[model samples]
Target: MVAIRIEFDDDEQYERLKKLKKHRGLTWKGLLLEGEKRVLEQTPE
Candidate 1:
């Protein structure tokens, strides 16, 4: 698996993601992967 890094300018947004990850019982990677998959599935081919 490939590793990636991202930065957030908004602390509130980062905090929200952290909360969501905990709420979903997922690691940061899992939450990002799930979000990526959902976005990809919704995008036009």
Candidate 2:
């Protein structure tokens, strides 16, 4: 598995992701994986 790192310059964006993880009942890692899946599903192979 590959690891990805993302940095946010704005506190609001970071807070939003944290809120989303809480709302979706997922950890940060899980939230990233969920986002990856969603993006990949929409991408053309």
On TM-score, the leading prediction is 2
For candidate 2, the 10 contiguous residues with the lowest summed lDDT are 2-11
lDDT of 2 by residue, 1-45 (tens): 977788997999999988999999998899988989999999999
Stretches of candidate 1 off by over 4 Å are: 1-3
TM-scores of all predicted structures? 0.76, 0.79
lDDT of each: 0.93, 0.92
Q: Who wins the lDDT comparison?
A: 1
User: Where's the lowest-lDDT run of ten residues in candidate 1?
Assistant: 1-10
Global CA lDDT computed for model 1: 0.93
lDDT of 1 by residue, 1-45 (tens): 987888988999999999999999999889988999999999999
Clash count for each candidate, listed in order shown:
0, 0
